[model samples]
Target: MTLAALAEQVGVAVVNLSVMKNDRARAVRFSTLTALCDALDCTPGDLFSVVDP
Candidate 1:
């Protein structure tokens, strides 16, 4: 889906979603994450992975 469509479906601003999509976001709210997961028909584990710092 397009970013605009995803943003609409996820109930988040396009700019915010763009930031996340581009890996430039510093953090993500749990509510936003859940909304995204629900909109995409996926799970948290599907969207994220451990990154060594």
Candidate 2:
């Protein structure tokens, strides 16, 4: 899904979504995480993967 579309659906900025995509997001509220998962038709694990940072 397009970041723009997701941002619009979640009422957030595209740049913020980009930050999350880049794994530079400092924090994410549970509500936002839930919304993201629902919008993307994915689980939280799909939105964020664990790896060496």
Candidate 3:
């Protein structure tokens, strides 16, 4: 799905979603993550990775 469509589904602005998509966001609210997970039919573990830095 397009980012615009996903944004609408997740009740977030396209620009904000774009920021998150581009890894520019320093943080994300749990509500927003839950919304995304619900919309995408996935879990947080599916969306994020803990990399060794």
Which scores greater on lDDT, model 1 or model 3? Answer: 3
For TM-score, the strongest prediction is 3
Best-to-worst TM-score order: 3, 1, 2
Q: Model 3, range 8-50, lDDT digits (tens) per residue?
A: 9999999999898887888999999999999999999998888
TM-score of 2: 0.83
lDDT of 2: 0.87
Quote the lDDT for 11 in model 2. Answer: 73
lDDT of 1 by residue, 1-53 (tens): 99999999888899999898888889999999999999999998998887998
Instruction: Report, for every candidate in turn, its global Cα lDDT versus the true structure.
Output: 0.92, 0.87, 0.94
* Model 1 clashes, total count: 0
lDDT of 3 at 3: 94
Query: lDDT of candidate 3 vs native?
Result: 0.94
